[model samples]
Each structure stands twice: as structure tokens, then as C-alpha cells.
Target: MQNLQEGERALTAAVAAAGRTRLWSHPELGLHAFVDAAGSVRLGTSDRNWAALVPLVEATATGHGRLWSGERFVETAIGDRLAYRGHETVEDGGRERTTIRLADSVTGLAADVVLETCRGAGFLRARVRLVNEGGTPLRLESVTTLTLGGIAGADDGLGGLTLHWADNDWLAECRWRRTAFRDQVVPLSRSVHGHEGRGCFERCSQGSWSTGRHLPMGALTDRDGRAWLWQIESSAGWRFETGEREGAAYVALFGPDDAHHQWHQTLAPGEEFHTVPAALVRTEAGGLDAAFGELTDYRRDIRREHPDHRTLPVIYNDYMNTLMGDPTTRKLLPLIEAAGAAGAEVFVIDAGWYDDDAQGWWDAVGAWEPARGRFPGGIQEVLDAIRGHGMTPGLWLEPEVVGVRSPLARTLPPEAFFRRGGIRVTEHGRHHLDLRHPAARAHLDSVVDRLAGEWGVGYLKLDYNINIGPGTENGPESPGSGLLGHHRAHLDWMASVLDRHPGLVLENCGSGGLRMDYAQLTVAQLQSTSDQQDLLRYPPIAAAAATAVTPEQAAVWAYPQPGHTLDEIAFTLAGALLGRVHLSGFLDRMNDDQFALVRSALRLYKDIRPEIAGARPFWPLGLPGWDDAWIAQGLRGRHSTFVTVWRRGPADGTSCELTLPHLRGARLQPSVLHPTASDSTAEWDATEAKLTVFLPRPDTAVLLRLR
Candidate 1:
């Protein structure tokens, strides 16, 4: 026993002699990580002290990581028991990537934490690779892709930290709300309890709809304006939590977990699993505006290259309040001409284009054939009409599902469809397609080839309307793992389609912003921001769309009816000018003046699109409220900054002030770029960096340009 104690002391001395603690810094991203001899990592921004940081890697396996008394994903035995391996850094195309390796001697679990950062960028992209080096299988319940600690206000402790998250729904997407961190994660006296609290403020995806409940993105800001923003890139399932740890705050981001997502994985010897990618952005000051700006840049850097991101073409879709999924040649010919005249570059024939049956087309929709009765001259005639008006032809398709009554549902193998208990899973009269199967992939490939290749379609709006519950049970894998596999395969299939048809623009729509995550947005060219029909209720969504997606990739609807006043028409049109324009409405029947107003908005958008493609989004009045009387959103570029303000209530004569601190001391000019004849006015105060704008009428909106 004495010899054993002496040997343990000698081993501890050897570890200390070998440098028990090491600090790793990524100056470009302002990230500092400290690793102790026990392989516990604490990550923080350079602005925080190393001593305040907590363990970075948190994991919970079947028989490990139960040391702490909490549902929180920290203090895992595997995390604390790991031994730090050497790290390697590599530079590729001006971006630097560093990999830190760690291994647990007890469980034989090895992890490679990979972080990638671009030069001069203020964000870090992170993912983890977990491998089983033991002779036996290891079951994993949860593992964090990225974890950060040591987050506290410069002056106060956790008292100054404010938590911000967005509540997402079908129509009410990106409804950002903020509260004091202490309000959600109440103080637990560690001095009395002698242990961390057992609860955390967590937001997680319920099922297939990643953003069905809340966005996979959030922020923490201090009173002094410093901000830390994070986003988990997963279309399958995700969870993010922030809680008090060791007198400070820590954030843990996970892809999927057993407790919340029914996702667990058993890794055999020599097997490995990779977590979904996540990103973090830290700003010294400026709060969410600055942090989100850096995140936008990072998003642009990581997404697949496509021309639609740069061109920012105006798209006219025959959905929303216009057609309501019922369309025909008689209804489309005039609209095509009118849309082309309104400067639309793409005209998409939305749902019901393939419905030939008297019954609705919702369930019987796998076959994407144009109805002969609706288009007696063939769908090609309308396609040619769109081309005649100098616009590219597009179509809407829901590729991930097959109608219960469709022939493809019977023809596709059972393995190709989502199955549970040896029976096919059906939802809303549709059977979900498991893209991991070759047959399912081939079917979608043939469909895309037929539309984009044979018919020469330039754009495709891939809509997913049904959430197919947990996932398929084809193999001996958890339902969560199955969902993750399908999500990855779906992304790969989209990328393959783009590789084959590089010019084809694909719009990602999941019942309107339900699947709004970076995993899908990084591949698809555009994301449908929402399907809200009421123009009045759309301002908040439009104002906060940038918080969920990049401005260039976010698609907002601008549906102006002919019965509305000029202000109403301009109000709807202005909401879409900052992002990709999805023009709808009865433009064919509108009076000349109303049509001209839409045309003017489109023309102005065309002029400013070059700057928008390179701009970073900022909210002057902070994130919009669901029922706020006033809302404001801005895009800042190199030479110009544009602001869009909407007044929805409080009658007339109401004005709002927007603070743009970045432009405080500049000699500037402010002009109403759209609806140039409206009664709305904008005045700039360089001394205070505030822009006071007034729209004399309610339900009115205006777009302003500052240079």
C-alpha cells in the first residue's frame, strides 16, 4: 500500500513535469482554450480570464460521466478522465483548421475535436469525431460538438448576462425574445449545496422539424455589449443549453441525444461517429448585432458555392395568397407576362401543377406531371410563355414524400420508405422517403433529371410539408441515428443534384421555415422564410429572418393585392427587398399604378442587390416583437447601409428612432429608396448615430438608403 501511494505520487509528478496545463489560442477567431493534464478543456474568448473557464468537452455514455448531479451535460467522467494528445494545424485556401485529440484510458474512447476558422474572421466552426479504441462496444447517449465556458460580464458575474433565443413556428418564425440569464437559470448557492445545480435552460428539437419549436441558434450578451452567439447545424435533431457552472456560465451544443431525441449510438471496435457541425462567434462589443454579423460572414464562407447567392434574382411564385395551390394555363399566362414586366427573373409554378384528379393533390403528389386538363397546350406552353417574357421557368416539388395513393408508393421498396415495427410509417397521407436507400435516391434523381434536365427547368422549390415522427427502423440503429443518416443523405442528394445541374436554383421549404437550419441552408440556394399570408403579421418575421439565415439566402414573400391601397402594396413589397424576393399577388389584374409600384420596388432591389450580396445584417431597434408597433431591420455594406422600417399600429404620427452606432460620425445622406412618393420620412443624426423615421399612416413601411 505504501509503494502504491509512492507510485501514484511519482506519476502525478511526472504529469506535472510534462507541463500539466497548456493554453491554445486562435487569435484570428479570438478563441482561447486551456487544457489541463487530465485533458479537461476550458474554452473562452480572449476577453475572459483562463481561471474562469470550465470544462469544454461534455459527454454522457451508458456507464460513464455520472459524476455531477445535474441534467446538464457537464462534469462527465469521460471528459475529465481524458488524456490530451498533441494537436495539429493546417491551412487550406486561407482558412486554418486545428485538431485536438483526446483519449480516455478507462473506456478507450478517443475524440478529435476539429475547429476551423477563416483568417480575419471572428467565428470558429467546430465538430467532433468519436472513435472506439476498446475491444468492446461503447454506447453513447450524448456528446457535445462544441462547448464553451467562462462567459460572464466584464463588471458583474452572471448577473449581467442576458439570454436571447428565437421561438419558431409555422408562420411565427424567428420571434426573438430576451431575458436575464438569472431569470431562466436561477442562482443555486454552491457554497451551501457544495455541488452544481441539476437543471439547465435548454432548447432542443422535438423531432424531424429542426426548427419546429425553437431555432437552433441563440445568443448571450453582457451589459457592456459583448456577445457570444452560437448555432448548431443539424436538420435531424439538436439541443443547446446554457447554465451556471463553477460561478460562471457555460454553453453545450449537441447534435442529438438519447434523453431528448431518442438518439443513441453503439460504436464497435474500430468504428467512429461524427457529430454535426456547429459554429460560435464572439464579439468584444456591439452585442448580437456584431456577433451575428461575424456569424453571417462565417455562414457565407461555409456554404456551398452557387450563383444564386450572388445574383439575388427576383422570383415570382404562384402560391401564397395568389393561387392558393390552384392554378391553370388560363390563370398563369397573364401573370407570367406581368411578372416578367415587373422584373422577375424566375417564375415558379407552385403546387397543384401536377394535379389532374378532382380530389385534392396533397396526398397523391409523387408523380410530378403537369395536368393535361389545366394546360391543354401542355406545361411546355406555359414554360415557353415564361421564356417568351424573358424569365426562367421553375417548378415546385415535394420530393421527400410519396402520396399514399400514388403509384410510386407501392413501387418503392419498403426499405426505401420510413418503417417502424416492420410496417411503413405514414403521416398526413404521405409516406416519408428514406434517402439512405438507393431506390429512394434513384427515384429523386430521376425526378430532378426529368425536370431540370429534360424540361430545362432553371429553378426547383423543394417543399417538405409533413414531419414523419422519429425515424425509420430499417437496421439495428436508434431512431435518432436513422434520422440523422437520412438528413445527411438528403443533403448529399441535394448537392449531387446541384453538381449535375449547376445553374439550377433549389429553394428549401419545409412548411415555411420549419427546417430552417444551416445543414439544409448550406446546400440549398434559398430558404423560404415563411408562408405567412397576412402582410401585417409578416413584418416581425421579415425583420428577424436574418437571425436564422443569411440575408442573401432568406426568401421573403411580397404579395400585394390590387384591392389594397398604395401604402399597403408598398408595405408588403418593402419587406422583401432586403432578402430574395418571392413576388406573388394579382399583378395581372392590378391597375397600372399598383403594378408600377411593384415594378419600382423590384427595380430598386435590382440596383441594391450587388451590395446586399456582400452585406451583413444588423438590427437597430433590436429584434422585433411579435406585436410591436414599430420594427426595423438593416443591412450594412462597404459604401452604403439600407434600413427597412414598418409601422403596423399605434395609428398615425408615430415615429421610431434607430441607432446605427457604426455610422455615428460619418457625413451621410439618407433617402427613401422605395415608394419614393410615400409620406414616410427619414432623418439622420450623425452626432447620436440615430435615424428617426416616421410613417404618417399605420400599416405603412419604407426602405431607406444611407451613404
Candidate 2:
């Protein structure tokens, strides 16, 4: 079995061999497009397997080339460089030729397989083209699978894992049990559920599932309406049952079936089909959020070079109803000043700054104007105020939407709006902008430029409240084209906006958790977890924390109302230990005791900010369940650590014993600090085994520091 590094090398060699045949030069990252050696056509990288495919060709192929027997074939090569193409061809006499073409756009014909080493956790992409060279339309079925090289086992590093999906449910047919060579299998029962408007159907899980064990990730689907994407991190592992079922056609190593799954399309007389699969390895170095952030940086470096990239953290001021209507500048100015004093790196002035009449701000999204009534001195005054407070100011814009009453609706080109005739007009208080159109890009760019250059806005929160329809609205188009226009437009807009703003922070939001996917994460700096911030909703939030690599980049807001005590609020705030923190409560309304508590917690968070931001997170207390309490901790280096614990409902007599891993063999001192009590500290040696701590109910948390 080849290791990741060795696999990458092998793959690179194969691409080089193929490149010689087509005489094509390889393209650099971000700028290159995969092409076919036979016909010299362009092929795009798969969304899932980008890392694996890009590097191999860049290292081997160079120049231009193409390989396609007809329009219905997949052809990809290293942009203008080496070309590697594989496809099936049918002759007039009912004969078929399935071949892999490798040619250098510079040199010419090479070998078959481009075996490159798989560095870190990456993917291997091979373009499959099916052409009707014999003057007839062809019907074909194909699937691409990678055989991993590693010892199969359960304890070899895989266990306690769960798969995530935007919409779907898991089914357990049997408990996980070890098989041969440390391999394990967990049985999955078939289940049906709706996921974000799509029907999901999972076949029974009948394959071995492991965390970092033999298999890191896997997906399986027939050419039907069922598809799956499964991934598990090395830090968290789970067991499952796997075996042949009585009626199933094939056994999948992982994933449940969902109804909303869509299948790859069929190639007509002049059509083509493309497929891609990607895999990544996880580790105990940090939570998923941190890991993802690192990956994003790596991919960015591989693709394009950004000269002035810097990390910027932000806090929202108007989220707590602090800024509504035409409030006196005197009232709002101080809060912004206070937030800046509290070490808030960026200050955002949310909605209501725009009026429906002037600049048509509220009703007119397309017209970028500040309401004169709301901002008597114009947006420049607000910007100057934020700058004076020693903080960067950010503005929120829902550029994708437009209100019906806005003047732009009547003046703008009719094609700008998305509609389905009278039955479905793109009207929902605001209409979504057609990003695919050139005019839309130009308009958005103008607005973004004004905010960045004119107002000196350092950050932009781009929010979208709608989904795009397929290209079917454009007439009789292919299923792929239906969504392609929107996809292309989104990519183009993101690239353009980021290029224009350079170092500006772009936070993506879709009502909240709806857009928490890799595609969006690639372009935006942060994502909102969900709108539900009630203290009781911490369990699901914590669960989601593991799924995404950077929950710290998630927007988590906390506040204390009249009925809730400061201690209760602190307990709730602890749950945010797994991610970034956003506070929305009215600070001025709090009493001295409550204010003091906030100050104390803020101080502690500030002290351990580095650790909480960079270290691997430990959910000592499992996901928050109703009537259940738990603790979450994160440790950085050897001496710094932060802990957060919460007790929901009435206090129970139950005490939780937490066994700390990665801390054994170290000298440590632990202390408990309550809002009403003084801090108590104790010393212990963790050299021999895991350190155990006991917590009584009503929820209490302790911080551990190494001496």
C-alpha cells in the first residue's frame, strides 16, 4: 500500500508519461484547467477532489492538447501543458475502444496511468470521456473508485465516527464489531427522511467504518437517484456494522441513503459525463474548524498568491436591537466606542441604517445609498466615528435581494429578476439578483468598491436568502446547465469581489446554517452557525462543532435577559468554547454584579484566547442534550487551557468524572471558579494516567494550568 506521499509521486509520474504523448505544458495552480491529450479540450477540477488532481498534472504535463472522439466525451489536461484523457469509444460495427490517452502539448504521446503520490490527504482525478465516433448516439454506465493502500483495522486509528449531511438521517442495523486485520464493520439499517427539501434514502450500512483507520472516507451510488458523501475525522471515531444484505445490489463502505440524492446524467448523441471523488485525513491537533481553516489556507496558497492576507475578527453591535430606526448618534456612538475599548477588532453596524425613501436604501438594494434621515451626516460620519474609536467598521449588505417597492425594480432591466411567469415571480419582499448576468456583476462590484474604497469598510457580510433555480428556466437545457449558470456566476462574483477587496474579510450567511458547505467556505472567511442562540440549544450547536473544521469562525451570539442571572449567562457562554463568540445582550441594562461577571469572563476569555483559538477541543461533556449538562475544554501548548461547563434544567445530584487524555505525564494544577465564589486551586501529577475531575450539578467549570 502506497502512503499519501508515495501515491502522489506515482500519480505525478503517470501524468508526466501521458503528457509526452500530447505535447502539452502543465498549468500553474488556480490558473490551470485540466485537458485531454487526444483532442486538446478543457476539463474543470472536481469540487471534491481538487487537491489531488491539480498538483499531479502541474508536476508532469506542460503545453496544450486535447482528446475527444465526439462532443459526448470528457477531455481534460493540465492547462496548455500535459494532457491525460480517458474515454470509451464505439465504432460503427458495434465494437468499442476504451483507452487512456496521455500526451504533452509540448512533446506528444505518453503512457496510460499517471500514478502520482497523494500528498497529505488529497484526491486523484481522471477524466472519463465517452464519444460516439461511429456516427451514433451511445448509452453507457460508469463509476470511478479508488482502492486505498493500508492495513485494515479498527484500533489502527478509526472508531466513534458520525457522517454529516445538510439533510439526512443515520440508520444502525447492528453494533460495530472487529473483523480480520483489525478491520471493523457496523451494520446500518435503511431509513428514509427529508433533507432540506430533498428526499433521502439510505441503503443499510453494510461496510466497515472507521475514523482514521484503514478507510478515511468513502461514497457509493448507483446511476439512480441515490448518492452519498461521507467523511470522519481522526479525533472522533465510531464503529458500525457491514455485510452483504439480502436484497441490496452493492454494499457501501459508508453513508445512508437519502431520497433527495441526484444521479449523474446520461450522455446523448453529443453529450459527456464527468465524476470526481475526494478524501481527507483528520488528526488530533485541533477541532474540525481549525483543521478546515488550515486546509483553506493551504489550498489558497496552492491556487493563487495573496500578498496582503490577514486574519480579522469581528463583533455585531445591532444584533441585540441596540440600533433600530433613527436613533440619536449620541446613543449609538458610545456603544461602538465601548466595543472598540473592549478589544473588539471589528465593529459592524447592522440593518436599519437605511431608509425606504432616501437612496431607496431599505427597499432598493441595487441603489447603494445611505438614508439621509437615518444618517443625517451621511455614512461618512458613522465611518469616521468607528475609526476614531480605533476599530475597523463593517457593513452588512443583502445584495442578492431587492424589494418590490424599490425604484430599481422598475428601472433595472427586466432580465435582472428571477421569475417563473405569473405562477412564480421572484417576489418575497425582495427579489434575488440574477448573478449570471454581466450587468449584475458590474453592479455588485461597484457597490463593493464604494464600501471598501469610499467608506473605508474593512469587512463585508454578504448574505443570501434564496436558492438559485436550474438553467431550465432558460429553455430546453440539460440538467447540468440548469444549475451551471448560477454556479458560474457565484464563483465569478466571489473571485472578483475577493480580488477587489484584497485583505477585506468576507463573512457568508444564508439565514444561518443553510450555507455551511465547503464550496462557500472556500470563498468566505466566516459562516453563521444558526440563528438559534437560546442557552438551551447548545447540544445541537456542539454536535455541529465537530462536523465543521472551524466552528470558531461561526457566528455565536449570547445575551442575558431580565429573568436570567449573570451566572446562567456565563454557563451558556461556555458552550461557545468550541467556536467564535458573538455577544448580543444589552450591556448597559445589566446591574453591577452582572456587569462584574461579564468583565470577569471577558478577562478570562481574553487571557486564554490564544489557546481557545488554536488548540484541539475536548468535549469532556458530550453534546448538550435536554436536561443534560456537559463540559468542553481546549488546550494549547503544555501550560495553557480553558474549560466551559453548563448545567441545564434543575440541579441534579449527579457528578461527572472527566478523564483527560493528552495530559497524562504532565504536572498540572486545576482550579474551580464560580461567579459567586472565590477560585480554588489544586495540584496533581498526570504522568502515569489520565487526570480525573469531578463536577457537581447546577453546572460548574474548572480551568487547568500546567505548573
Candidate 3:
């Protein structure tokens, strides 16, 4: 034991060593790294036999390498070794942003590696830019955003390392699966190469929702308890791969893989191509949750500054149960009144507010205007009504598409919409607008300014409901490149809208979470987790959403219907407790008793909502299974932990236990934050480091705080 402790101390010292270059270390997080003069990177969590390796950040031209024989980062082909050019560092909101420049003289390629961090933060973000400085254009086949070479440097083989991959779908989001990195990705090999060889495990997102097929994030944990999580922030194509080769194992992150993406950009002289930003979190203590907890902090650090994320306002949309996009003045009055009474901060009149009541309103939606019949006294009357209740008025706008039958669809030039082969690309009877074009931007800007600026609306729920496949082929670039370009332009446009309305908040929704990516989340104040109304299935999405986004940005609906019992009402409300509560359903029709339950939950949500801004997410019962009878997701704050547990189905899961060893050694006082029911019981079993709960019936939920 003494010898083992001495070895661990030696590894700690070695991990902290500056080696050939000055090492940058996060003082409190125990993360350390250094880049040598040759552009080789050595980093890790400072645990023995568990270090990250990046011997090369290679890029191969058409004629480079052993002609692309599984070679990473153009290592053996360049005539001259990559040399460190210089470095620049800047600070943003207390975080350090460093740009380290490296160049290969023979290849005439300059790589600017950008990294972000803080003194005590447990995470760092990295990306690379490849610039062509040579006399002619070069066709680059493969370029990796980040190549974490030697991810398992000291180990003979990555036999014990585990990879955690997150998967997402339409209603099902943030599903995480943990498997042996070797067995799942790169199979453990009996046939070894020298003393340090390994196989590869790779996963990637092809287009659009990077988490559509699988999330653009993953984590690897070693036997010694060292864990590192890496996530890609792009909404477009992104990839991450883990492999063993030569004498080491590696994890490489990329924006697009040329093999599948058909992406090969020819960089002209003085031209540059930058990869998407990616972040990595490392921890040697408390396992995966600890690493992710720091990642949560890093996620918060990277988000664009906004007050709404801090406020976590409860939104009441006129969609789900009451109106369903067919809101009239009569329908809006009673629902709006109930919403205010239930403690909603923003009352958004969802879809169909603009269309004539007689016409179908699904597709012809570009020209955003209040219908004469729907709003008899104009939209302002409803706005005044909402203000009278002391709540902000918001409206839903699908700014990206124009209805095919709408006048603007024919009036706007073909160049304004996504085009292919000299024609507008129509999907689901709606034409997607190419925001990159000035005309398209002008149209949407006018709509936003009128609603938010003229009408004094404080919030805009931006919705996009169509998928134009890879993208439009009308522009000079490929469809994928065009899509990415439009994505950046759209984000800029959203920022401009925010600038126009200083107090306005934007909600991002793409057919409910199809575009729920970090790129959109950065600018948009919040994300609609799902449109699923099933109270049972929603718990999983709400529980898992924290993995994909911060709890504050995850707008989960706590819709309680008029027919639901008190137990059923609590079950519905619990899903949104730890997230941004997007209250919905037919509250106007609900009885006073049924409505009181919602108001009780809302009061509790408002009380604890502030702490959620600075909280770190955790799955006390692990990532909630889609069909799990009982599920739990929680947030740990500075002085308290808030947990929401749901018992669903007739599975007789009223009696359940939760293990929260995070407060194991501390003296904690536990109490119900929401539900406030006399029958619901949560008793702390300190000896076992668990909290056991018992409810009399199914479809019931409870919110508990342990401080």
C-alpha cells in the first residue's frame, strides 16, 4: 500500500511536470497539459497510466502520407516536422482563450490551435485551423478538429478503458450508454503491435442534429478512476473516434470526415479553414459525474451572456392542450387568465395566431401578422390583457420557412429561399429561407422588429419545422457547406434580434428539438425539450435533457390536464422541476383543486429556480431508461441538492430508493420541495447513504431537497 501511494505521488508529480514547455494546469480541477515545440501534445487528469496523447495534429493533402494508410494528421509525410510558431492569449468573462500557432514549412500549412480554460475550471475547449500559405491550392482529404493521440499512453493496451456515448431521437433525448471502449468501438486485440498498439472505436453525426443518430459527445474512463469527457459544440456535422495504433490509443474529434461527408475544401494561397469548437473535461475523483459536473460549469461558461438563463422563467405556451395552434380571442382569454394564476412569467400565443381562422394555417406561415378574426381587437388587445396580469407577452414565429401558398412565397425571389437546380426546394409544403441572403434576412428582421419592437413583446419563440436534407445546392459551395454557412448567418441574425430588443428572450424549437444543438442554444435563451404530451414518456426526456443541455435551458413541459388526479398532476409537474418549466395543458378547464397542485409546483419552482442557474446536473438513479418505472434527475448546488423523482405506469414502483453518495459524509437535512403532500414520504438512510421513498400510488412524483 505504501509503495502504491508513493507511485501515485510520482505520477502526480510527473503529470504536473512542465517537461519541455511550460505546462498549463487548472489549479483546482487537477487537469494539466503541455505542447512541445514539435506540436505534440501530452495531457491528462494526472492519474497514473491514464494520459491523453496527441503526437500529431495531422492534415493530409491529395498526394500526402503513405497515401492515406490510416495515418492521422499527416505525420510521416511532411518533409519538415511541425514547429511552434507563436501563441496569443486573451481573457473572456474570466476564462482564458489561448491560440497556439504551429506550422509545417514543407507542406506550407499553418495550424492555429485555439484553447480555452480558467484557473480552477475542470474543463478546456480546443479547435484547430489549417491555413494554406503555399503558392498553389491544395485539396485536403481529411482534417481532424482535435486528435487526442495517446489517450491511453502509459497502458500497454486500453483493455480497461470504458466509453460513454449519448444517443438522442425525436421524443427520446439524451440516452447514454456505457460500454468497454475496446469491446464496443475498437475490439480488444490479441494480436498486438510491439508493446503499445490498440484498435479503434469511432462514432459520428452525419448532418443537422449531431445528436440525431448519436450525440457529438463521449467519455473514456480508465481503471485507475481517471475520466475524460469530450463534446463537440457544432450543430452541423461532427465526429469523435477512439482507436489503438502502433503503441498507443487515441481519441480524435472532427467536424466532418471526408470519407463519408464528401468534404474536401481546396484552400487557395492565404486561405484558411477552421474546425468547430470542442471541449474536454478531465477528473480523477468521483468518477463520471464529477467530470460531467465540471463540464456543466464549462458549458455555462461558454454560453452567451443572458439574464433569462439565470431567471429560468416559467413559460405558458398556448399550444399543447388548450389551443394547439388555433388560438382565438375567446380561447386565449380564459387560458391566459389561468396561466397567470398558475405563476407563468411569459404567455406565448403559439401557431395559428397569424392565419385567417377560415384557412388552414400549417404551411402558409412566412408573413407573420395577427389574423383579424383570431384577434378581434388586434394582437395589442391580447398583449394589454397579458400585461394586466403582470406577465410578458410572447408570440411564436417560424421565421425560416414561407408557406408555398403564401403571397411572399411568390413575391420573394428564388434566391431568397433554399434552391436546387435553379428552383426553390420545397419540403412539407414550405420553402426554407436561406438566411445568408440579404433579402431573406430583411424579411425576417422586419417580422421580428414589428412583433418585438413595435408591439413591445418581450419574447420570441423561433420555430423551424422543415428539413431541406443536406442543404440547398444553389450556392457556390456544397450543400453541406451551404447549410453550415446558413447556420452561422442565422445565429448572427438571432444575436442581432436580441440586440434590437434588449429585454427580449428567444426560444429555439425545430419540430421540437431537431435543432436543439449548442450552436442554437448559445444564442437562444432556451430549448423546447419535446412536444410529447404523454406524462409517462416525458419523464425520460426531461431527465436526460440535462446531459445534452444545461438544466436552465431545457424547457420541459409540466402540462397537467383537467382530468388528471392529484397524483397524476404531481407526476406531470415533476418532469419540469429541475428544468425550465414550460407549463401547458388545459388549466382553464381544470378544477380548483387540480389547479392548486400546479400553482403549488409553480411556487416551488420559482423558489428554487435561481439555484438551478449555478447547479450541476446528475442522474441519481443513472440515466433514466425510456421505460423505467421510476426515474430520477437532480441538480447539485453550492449548499443544496434538488432531486425530482417520478413513479410512472402501473408497475407498482411506489417504493423506490436513491443513492446520493455526494452527500454521504455530510450532515444533510431532507425535505420535500414540491408536491408538499402528506402521503409522500422520503426518509434518509444515512447508514447506507441512500434516500428511500414511498408513495401510496403510481403516476406520482416528488421533489426533495437535501442540504
Question: Which number leads on TM-score?
Answer: 1
Distance from true location, Cα of 178 in model 1, Å: 0.4
TM-score of every model versus the real structure = 0.96, 0.64, 0.90
Error of 3 at 657 (Å): 2.2
lDDT of the candidates, in the order given = 0.88, 0.42, 0.76
Give the runs in model 2 whose Cα sits over 4 Å from its true position. 1-278, 282-314, 320-331, 357-364, 419-427, 467-472, 478-480, 539-543, 560-564, 591-593, 603-606, 611-614, 621-627, 631-641, 671-707
Better of 2 and 3 by lDDT: 3
lDDT score, candidate 3, position 552:
92
Steric overlap count per candidate: 1, 107, 8
- Taking the tens digit of each residue's C-alpha lDDT, what string does model 2 give over 82-154? 3444422223332222233433433332323222112333222222223323233332221221111111112
lDDT of each residue in 1-707, candidate 3, tens digit only: 01111232343344346444434456664555555434444444342433235433656667665323452332335412555555556665666766666677776888877777885677778888889988888777566666554555226457777778877777777778888766764543435532232325667766555556777788888777677788887776677777654335567777764564545667899998887788888787666777778888887877789989888888999898668888888888888899999999899999888988356877777889889988888889999899888789999999988888888998888888887667788888888888889999999999999998889999888887766666666555556666666777888999999888878999998777767677788888898888787878888889888877888999988778998888888888888889898888889999988998899899988888889999999877878778988888889988789888888877665688899887776666678877876488788877678988776677778888998
Worst 10 residues of 2 by lDDT: 254-263
Candidate 1 vs candidate 3: the TM-score winner is 1
What lDDT is obtained when candidate 3 is compared to the true structure? Answer: 0.76
Cα error of candidate 1 at position 601, Å: 0.9
